[model samples]
Target: MSNAINVKRAAVASLMDQLRADVTEKKLTPQEELAILEKLKVYGRTVAGSDAIYSSEGIIFLAEVASRPDNPDSSREALRCLANALYLDRQTVQYFIDAGYVEKASEAYKSENVDDEFLLGRILFFSTTFSKDDKLLDKWVNEHHLVENNIAAIARHATAYATAASTASSQAVSMMQTMALQDTLKLLYTLTTKLPDVSTTLGPTIPHLLSLLSSIPLQSSPLQPPTHHVLDALSNIPPTTPDSQASYFPTSDPTLHVSKILKILDKAAIPATSATSSRSTTADDFDSRAASLLKLLIEIYPPSPDVVKQLIRDTLLPSEKERSLPLGSQNSATLPARLLRLASSPTTTNTRIILQTLLFVISDEDPVKFVKNVGYGHASGYLMMRGIPIPSEALEEIAAESGEEGGSGKRINPITGQYLDDELKAMEASNVKGLEGMTDEEKEQEAEKLFVLFERLNRTGVINVENPVRTAMQEGRFEEIKSDNEDSDDDDNEAGKGKGKAKA
Candidate 1:
């Protein structure tokens, strides 16, 4: 290890000496500088080597080299080394911050070359992540217009990549361009997450990002980096106005944008069920984010186009076949059923809340409509959790109100959200379990448990209703009984006395 360190130190020293000579003599070509930076880049991958680079003032050298516009290739390579160094050794970011790296890097961020923008954007992003200096971020956005440049970078690369992806057959070039776009997005995410107000300026990025979603195919793990990153970035910056948001979708095919996003949401949230299928917490988070973004698209102020709203409704709501089964049945085969399953899962809390909120928005946030759409079985939990009072009319089927059918003829099973015909069949099944075989004690225990649950729900003030147990007692429907523990203690005492008397 010592010998290796010695060798690395000597190599770093020689490279630094050559860099200094070339800066003064101007003899080494841009290719030579790149060669040197490539070597430095490898060395900086470890802490000891990073310390070697920092010790020899290689950061300042790299920063100065990256600042040179005439040597764009060499400058980009230099920036890559600096970015790697900052990432490998986080403490080195303070050194870069002190050297005004953000200021220097921000100037080169708008380069027409995609590679330059990618490397510099990453460097700036790293500074934001690792630097303790709070004002550094302020300087990046408030002073340097980092948000605007990133937006432009995203649009430019997205268009270029989309065009290339469509026309070019080379997967390598497409992958590189894809990576460049992803880095710009990551930087933008850091900026927006830190100062969410910056999202207001992010209006220009929406259309490009939406377009990229179609061009970029999601991997087997649907919520992988670029796709998920795009979803998340879009979520952070929905347009403030209906017209503005509407304009972001293609005028020729408005459903195109919404459809592309919805496809990803379904793919991620509703994984294919096979022997090989696996689910991860990360994917759940991604799907939740996608759901939230879809909600934003659906609930835009002043309303989206009727066609767009109808498209979302058609895509997300229960189909006729799905309506034959319970709204969130385990065997139900539909996107809405799958999403409802996710929303009610114990492990996927965020996904549950997001999907529920998405459905609620689709229902116009009316309690009655929400229940009618998803059935009282699924809607009750979300409504109670959100403290929204369940509407009395939502719990039972109503005769079709005048002119309400609008040509869509179906009678809803108010409890299951299924068609009334199927619900009747299910109710007629004799195999349905009930309390018939339970002992008296067991039935009492079950009743007590239900009473406790209602009491707790009432205490939360989530709903205003008398506890059923209290009402039952007041109505003389239940009789007071000794506590089970007290009865057990008395039995034990009698047994003990019987044993003592036998011994006497």
Candidate 2:
């Protein structure tokens, strides 16, 4: 009896497995598929243990099953399954759309009670896959109405889909279809006005979309309505506030949104001359725009040396006159200084420009005086080591001026020997004044001692020089003379003795 019960349980499990496979393959007849779908929906809601079965393949199967009859009710069920499947695997939904499953997907998207997840998935699928199908997009747009919630949904959809499609061929197509300059501008305006939170929530996505639109090359014609619209939209975004919007800067990736904007500007063909303007405008307008964009960039992104160097080279270098203008002028040095501070920062990639600028400022004036008086003495040591050439003409002029002065008529000492009589007297007086605090008795005693020492030296006619070795050498010379005299007497005595002996 136990073996029979086990067999019955195994048979029921096998039947359920077969039924699931049938649903996945869409092999059921329309009526049968509908009934199974209803059961699956119930299972999806209550089969507390079978949630893991809703794979991408399962959703594709269900979407296929619903499309079999092309009826509204079936389409709704198919969309729900597809939505659940997408929640599981977005790539799978994209795959289905690529395989020409878009029409069926759109049918399901039209459900009145569609969840945000389902709506978002369908919008992405449609924007990415059927980007060129403006009629379909228009139909959805018209039916959805231009309400904030709908627009927000569309914005979110555009942003999310664009992020995913960034690398796909669909990016170009999607930009061409849904993201014209005008539409992007309008969308951005609406987004910024209604959803200020977008700066934080869709931080990376908004710039990417803007970059794609910006990249489209503009024609030579006067500012078109669409061009103006895009410009206006860009202008509307508040200049990036450092505290709240710091994360919007381009990342380290080479394929960043800012790069895309640069490429777009490169492709654009601005008019050579405008009718309303008398001045011949080159690419300065674009450069100004680029600079403005970079201003926000510097505020949001940590300053990088490369970014700073590029700003100097690209923005400040070209407009030297503007950069050098007086402080209050339209083109003043303030902006350039701010940019240089950012680019020439110690942490930046290129610090040579900063060093060079400092050197130039130092060298422009009388550098010696500047170094001596301006607390730049440390810099002087560096300058000397760096072998900066002192101007030969300046050296010659200094020599010539010095030559005009008369030389001193008398010179005695190479070391402290040139004092005049009055100078020596003044030095003695100062030394005497230094002892003024001594008692009168001490002063008289010092004077009397000096007088006695000089008198004794005069009487002896001796200075009593302190060198003992020299005194000993002089005494020894005198002793040698006296001994020679004694030796002469002894020689005489010896000679007399020799004569006497000869007489005898």
Model 1 per-residue lDDT tens digits across residues 1-504: 888888888888888789889977999987888898888888877767445577527787788888887977777778878878877776677778888878867766877676777688788888877767667777877788777778788888677757766875555345656677778888877766677554456666777777677777656666677887787677777567554566555578867777777777677676334334465654555555555455555444225567877878887877656777888787875778877777776656456677788888888899888887788778888898888998656755552344575323667767687777666667667554334545566656666665656555666775555554555566666655555343345434332222210000
Off by over 4 Å in 1: 21-32, 54-56, 129-138, 141-145, 165-173, 195-200, 217-222, 249-253, 271-302, 397-403, 406-415, 419-421, 427-430, 433-504
Overall local distance difference test of candidate 2: 0.38
Clash count for each candidate, listed in order shown: 1, 4
Extract clashing residue pairs from model 1. Answer: 343-352
Residue-by-residue lDDT tens digits, candidate 2, 58-96: 545555655654555655565555544554444555555
lDDT of each: 0.70, 0.38
Winning candidate number (lDDT): 1
Model 1 TM-score?
A: 0.77
